[model samples]
Target: MNESTRQSSEPETKRQGLSGNALGAIFMLLSGLGFTVYIVLSKTLTEDVHPVFLAFWRSFIACLISVPVIMRAGIGKLKTRHPGLLLLRSLFGTLGFTLAIVAISADFDLTFSQFNAISFSRSLFVTVLAAIVLRETVGIHRWGAVGVGFLGVLIMVVPGVFIFWAASGGDGFSLDLGTMTAIASAFFLAFAIVLVKSLSAELSAVALLTYANVLSSVLLLPFAIYYWSTPDLETWGWIIVMAGVGFVAQYCYISAVSVGDASFISPLDYLRLPMATVADLIIVGMLPGMNVWIGAAIIIVSAAYITFRDRNKKAQKVKVLTDR
Candidate 1:
């Protein structure tokens, strides 16, 4: 192309990139709002419904929701060469989903902000798992960020546990089930993410999501039945709404990643912490402790730095290859 033509096209290309990034940011914000709604609804319903049962219905509904996509894509499109790996991925995902629900259930007594803050640790867990399982190289910078991230988690969790111990007159020390389950959920979710990264080369997104939801339904069916309590009509309405909102949120997240630079879009996801905090204050009339706010800020900074570093490394590698 001639100099004038290329110069004109450069401006247009920059504009388009900015536009796509703006759209992705909007989608990320909407996703954060949708998830906040879903979590609030789950907390409300868990007043009467069992979390296990709620989890089963969520998976079942999500599976049903995927029907139209599958039909449009053709059944053969769902076939995978790595069924065993897919199953393992689904198992970890199901465990993560169920435990997350349980962590926020009424019986668990965890505030929404606390749950959201802890959930951010999934990225840290992913870094660790990638190093160990994927044998990915971990530079000192990323390792330091991970260390800071765990320190943030400790800041959020340890203080509360100590206060509770003091309240109990220091008779015995025990961590709350809610905190344990929240951490477990993040770990399992990270493992599932690592597996998905491995499988993405061989499977389409539709296949991965469809298989995960379907298998989650199957795996949780027996437990759901054993713990089942029939929901009233009102509860049923909320359950359906929760499923729909969750699906849309998941779609928005996927879209955001696909359409724009992931590093640019990812920090927007931290909006969920504030979104949840506001929703909790308005709906449940509760605020997370000061530690939650402080710790979550630290975790967000750490995670964003990790993402920035990873993006820079990838860009450098691409530049090296192109130079060669």
Candidate 2:
């Protein structure tokens, strides 16, 4: 085998009866579980608590949890040269986070799996946003992938609505409002992803996260405090758990990528759909519609293809440079 082929295979080598890919898959699965659980916890609280307040407290608790870790990086890491990009990313991240909670709120009346399915579209959104914001070259293949992926999103979101909307007298369209909001949440998050790419050149991940938490808390403090009510003991327990687990989920994702190639580990994240489905079934006796499964599968495949292709393209570029 060539050096490149051997290099690629190294991550797959087993040690202690487990390979890096296996460990990465495990971590990604755990991260997905943590994230899904956090969403479920937030959904539970949204009935009794306002979404805005929930969003703010999530940031607040995350801020508290991150204190020691950020402190270890010292106050200096908190300072960044790219203040404008940082601020923009933070705002976008906060809005995305808040919108996600609102989508899962009682106002939406969506099933747990349905709400989580919206996130499948995020990678599609990121592709479009990258082209627009980053001026990246997107080949026709990727464009086709994006188009097909969004068809899947529509399938999951509106399903029969498009076919029957005129016959249903528009009621079907209105009923899809919740799903649309979830897609919008994904849009904002994809925008944040593009911004993070730009800022990563100058910022540590910890610094970026700290800024997001602090800024989100500050920006959201007024609204949260305005709607705040004293939570009962049980609610407090959920709040702490949600915050702590959510933060850990972020670390789990980071560590997963650090341990294995992004292409190998990213596919494992699709496990979240089944994980969320099972969670919904057990916790709320809810099951995702067939449309959601079909759509999610399409989105997952398209997103994985995009990631894999991008990794190969980057590797080829490196190979070309090395040959020179």
* Winning candidate number (lDDT): 1
**Model 1 misplacement above 4 A:** 1-18, 160-174
Ten residues in sequence with the least summed lDDT for candidate 1 = 165-174
lDDT of 1 at 270: 96
Per-residue lDDT over 11-39 for candidate 1, one digit per residue giving the tens place of the 0 to 100 score: 99887765778889989999999999988
Q: lDDT tens string, model 2, 59-151?
A: 999998776788997988777788888889988998888999888877777777777777878889999999999999999989989998988
Q: List candidate 2 stretches off by more than 4 Å.
A: 1-19, 159-175
lDDT, candidate 2, at 254: 73
Say what the RMSD of model 2 is. 4.0
